[model samples]
Target: MPPSLVTIGHATFQSQTLGDLQSGSLNIFLPGLNLGLHAAPTKQWVIVLAGSIKVYLQNNQSEANTAFVSSGTSGILLVVDTKDVSPVGHITETIEQTALLFMPTANGTVPEHRVLHNHVCAGEDLL
Candidate 1:
């Protein structure tokens, strides 16, 4: 049987008034979506809101490791040591699609919550 559709809500973040909040701008990954192997300088956190997927990592010794992540699951906090951190294996989704949130860790900086849709006040709805 196919997996049921999950209703995942977006998170809200605190931003300056001058900043505009973009909604529905999230990138969705369908089944069999290949996010070609790539690496960054800092560590990254990937949150899966829906569906499941497999992840492969290559070590310095040319060795590779694999990990599985389920729906509503999160990937390990990985710090890329080199510039070309490529996936040694493939990631296959167990479900139809997966929703993921990716954030990079930096110098004393943290990821913020972002709402998917805008919420208007009662009186503002009339405008």
Candidate 2:
């Protein structure tokens, strides 16, 4: 059987202080799927909410990727350096919308941090 899924919204914060905070929903394809995190010659951070997702670091043989994260869950802070030019794998929700946060490490940096939060939405709080 397929794995179950859930959804949740997160707290609010100033975009200027937190790099670039933008809220949005995502549709994920299930069954051994991959959410590609392309290399951009900079550092990045990502979080997962709603459904279960598996993170895989490319080019690194020493350490393995992260495990599956369930609903109302949060992922570890990912630090992708510029030297590594591989896609980070992640499995997202298939039916529900996942609120994500993507931000650049520094000014004019290519690779940026992508964060996902797990919190239910109220209707009026979708900014």
Candidate 3:
């Protein structure tokens, strides 16, 4: 048997919007897709409106850490520190042909909501 991939569930979570609220674009990712390791272009929040996605992230502490999110999963993604002295950044993939809302940050500044663990586990845990 293969390792079961994590699937996020729906539950209430306390959160505050980070960036200045403004109109942004909507993106749709198809199914059976595997996106390469990459980072957010600027400080922004990625809201999973439909379907699910798996975020692959690595920081100074560990590698191979992933957060699975479905509809209602949202988080603040910071800029990738790819400097020679820094660790490699993270990546994301559309697990269920996800639809996303890219909420832009204010003046490209880091949001008030800090990325405590360099990654987020939004939404609920799937049973």
Candidate 4:
């Protein structure tokens, strides 16, 4: 499952345990900051607070390959395209001033999660 719905302390909530979080950072990306065909330095989760970004797969250049990650947890990203691990990566461009939280996992490991639909989870899926 993507996010499990569970009850804890008489309260039900949607949650998913990723893994041990290393030292993280709240980053502020200014406008026009574009990393052309860049891979992630490490495996980390990114939660957007404000603004938006566009990510396109390295080999593909098409609308369907473009991912518009906007200001929300709904589009949470787990970037793991390291230079040595991955031959190619994605192209990232900032849409505006963006505030993001980068939480890198321990040992550069990525958490396991089931893809719901188009890599998106709906409210009904929780039930």
Candidate 5:
């Protein structure tokens, strides 16, 4: 499906449905905190609200393989890697005081999206 523009009032906006969310939580982490290698409990949307963090997969935690995201659309990440289907998890390290928004979906369902980059959204996604 292609994205279409909808005019709500005087401005136009792109509208799309991700998925049915179960619940949401706010997670705050201190600087220099390494969450270590882990996988998401379920499928969810992770949004960096503040500061920055480096995320790497369990199989690869190198600086180059790490995925970096900040606060905004570019920071949106869909975590589908679980302990059941996949053995690989992800690692998170806080460079500063980082606030993350965790929105878990129902029954580990993932949203429909085309990844701009490897695992994270690239800047070109805004265009």
Candidate 6:
């Protein structure tokens, strides 16, 4: 199945200070031999912090296609859909052992730390 394109944009929020917004979490996936196939666990943002990754996606009627994302030196962000209409997706391979940051949406209840500048931060960091 071919992949469908969704509108995305990179917006900057001008805040005096980073305040408590919503419940969110961070996760880092280390460079593995292979990431394999799977769908997003939740509606979240996948940030490529380092290396490169190719996302494979397809709908019920289209052929799967590839989307390449890399951090270069800084990073790249991808907003993924975990809703019912989300296309079936997975990571076919990592060109450079990718590092991913997953931040769930505010509407989700992922039992994550939601406080800003708190003693405990919720998320996973893998090397």
- CA lDDT of every candidate: 0.42, 0.39, 0.57, 0.76, 0.78, 0.48
TM values, all candidates: 0.44, 0.36, 0.62, 0.80, 0.83, 0.50
Give lDDT: candidate 3, residue 98: 77
Predicted structure 2, TM vs. truth: 0.36
- Off-target runs (Cα >4 Å) in candidate 3 are 1-15, 21-23, 59-64, 73-87, 118-127
Candidate 2 local lDDT, 91-120, one digit each (tens): 232233444333445543433333343222
Q: Which is the winner by lDDT between candidate 1 and candidate 3?
A: 3
User: Against the true structure, candidate 3 has what lDDT?
Assistant: 0.57
lDDT of 1 by residue, 43-63 (tens): 444556676666555422222
Q: List the pairs of residues colliding in candidate 1.
A: 11-114
Off by over 4 Å in 5: 1-4, 115-127
**After aligning candidate 5 to the native by TM-score, how far in Å is the CA of 101 from where it should be?**
0.6
- Provide the lowest-lDDT 10-residue window in model 2: 118-127
Q: Which candidate is the best by TM-score?
A: 5
Misplaced by over 4 Å in model 1 are: 1-25, 59-64, 73-95, 108-127
3-57: candidate 5 lDDT, tens digit per residue: 5688987999876565899999999999999987787788898889998998886
Q: What is the full ranking by lDDT, best candidate first?
A: 5, 4, 3, 6, 1, 2
Residues 1-127 of candidate 3: C-alpha lDDT, one tens digit per residue: 1123443486544434444654477999998687675545555666778888777665322333677667742433334344332346666777777788887666665545334453444443222
Pairs that collide in candidate 2 are 8-119, 8-120, 9-119, 9-120, 45-113, 45-114, 46-114, 47-115, 47-116
Show model 6 residue runs off by greater than 4 Å.
1-32, 59-64, 72-75, 108-127
Best of the two (4, 5) by lDDT: 5
lDDT: which candidate is best?
5
Alpha-carbon RMSD to native, per candidate: 15.0, 12.1, 9.6, 3.4, 2.5, 13.8
Candidate 6: residue 43 lDDT (0-100): 54
Clashes (candidate 6): 5
Q: Residue 125 in model 3: shift from native, Å?
A: 11
